[model samples]
Target: MIELLVNLIVSVMAAATPLLLAATGELIVEKVAVLNLGVEGMMLMGAIAGFAVAHETGQLWLALLAAIAAGMTLSFLFAVLTLTLQANQTATGLALTIFGRGFSALVGAGYVGIAAPTLPKIHLPVLSDLPFFGATLFSYDPLIYLALILLAATAYFLTRTHAGLILRAVGDQHDAAHVLGYRVIRIRYLAVLFGGAMAGLAGAYMSLSYTPLWAQDMIAGRGWVALALVTFAAWRPFWLLIGAWLFGGIMYLSLYVQGLGVPVPSAMLSALPYVGTVVVLVLISRDHRRIRLHRPAMLGRPFQATN
Candidate 1:
């Protein structure tokens, strides 16, 4: 029973890794009061880009870099439209999702059946030789550790750093930030790009590490889940980590039940994650003050610097 539980936790961490990375990126984006709804689309583009490059070059690192570049490119377009042209954030984000889906399908058509180079798992010299703990913690691909590191780094940056404070100031009061001579749009651009890079990394994790294959819409709504996760986490990095693991556990529980020969419908099992998302959102929404306190004050609002 202990072994089984450990295995379940290991699987949950693998599944949750990508979501955690994506959510962390979105957290930063929202922190700057710019809601780029193109996360799903960016992820799709990253998946295909990473897959194609990995299949062709057999270089997993290059493939990951390609994914980051792809996501950043899409995000750059988003910044141009919304930040420069002042396009409606909602409409632009929706269009980006549609575009990414179609564009990725077209790009990935040739590589549909291609097998990608598997990422190497990090095995510690002595610890990895340990009986149970090593398998549970030290046997994951590098991306998994990177996700944890990112969570820690983000938490520190947000809570213990001055630049992070300034970013929060920008999110909370862009006009005030502008009065203090902080370039609101510039900071927002960096935040959006950083969000894009992380989304791409998440996509790379999905294709190169998680499943390591190419398929249509293979991201499978993970992007949307990540977006909802920011809300579910109340915009805090640590809370986001907990929320991601909870969702991941729920998803794996469905599969575990199915494997146990339970008579539950597979369709319902597949819907478990989304259902969990809805429930969490409802619970979070119930506390209006909590949401108000943590949510970016100027989220989704377009910023124009007054010279």
Candidate 2:
């Protein structure tokens, strides 16, 4: 029983890693009120970019950097369209998703069969030896642990810092922030890019560390799930972690059952996480008065300097 439980925990962590990373990034982005629907697109871009770079160079660090760069670069396009050009944020974001998917497919075609090197684990002395949890929680690939650190730091950064307060001000009310002499647009730009980079990095890690291979549409709607997670957490970082892990566990449990020869049908198992996504979405939408209904206030609303 314990062994089965251990394996289950490990699988859940692995499954949750990419979602956690992406959700953490989005949480930061939404905190500043710029909703970028291109997370899946950026993640797909990072997945291929990181995979191609790592395949050529065999460097994990370089792969991660390339992935983040790709994500941020794409995000800049989003910023230009939504922020500067005043394009419809929703339409533009969805367009980016279509563009990213098709673009990632084209780029990934050449490296269909190749596998990128994986990230290495850092095992702590004495701590990693603590029966099940030591390996399950403490002894993970460095990025897995890094995901936790990102979560904690983000939680602190949002709740503790002056900059955080200022960013919140901008998201919650842009005109007021501008009236206070704050660079509302500039702060938002930074927030969007930060969100993009983190979202991209999350995608990169999925490719390099988790999947370790390139494919078409491999992000598998994790981006939308991350968006939903923001509402589940009520814009709070700790709930973001919980929501991400819950979804991740659903994803991993489906596979683990198959691996363990559980009697459940494969089709049902595979569809579970997505099914859960719909259920959660319904629950989030059940409330209308709340501001963060999977979206921050002033999100998708243009913030013009004069208007």
For candidate 2, lDDT tens digit of each residue in 249-301? Answer: 88987777788888888999888989998898788667876544445677657
Score residue 55 of candidate 2 by CA lDDT.
91
| C-alpha RMSD of each candidate structure in angstroms | 1.1, 1.9
| Model 2 poorest 10 in a row by lDDT | 288-297
Candidate 2 Cα deviation (angstroms), residue 256: 1.9
Model 1, range 76-173, lDDT digits (tens) per residue? 89989999999999898888889999999999999887798978899878877888677666688999989999999999999999999999999999
- TM-score, candidate 2, is 0.94
Each model's TM-score? 0.97, 0.94
Clash count for each candidate, listed in order shown? 0, 0
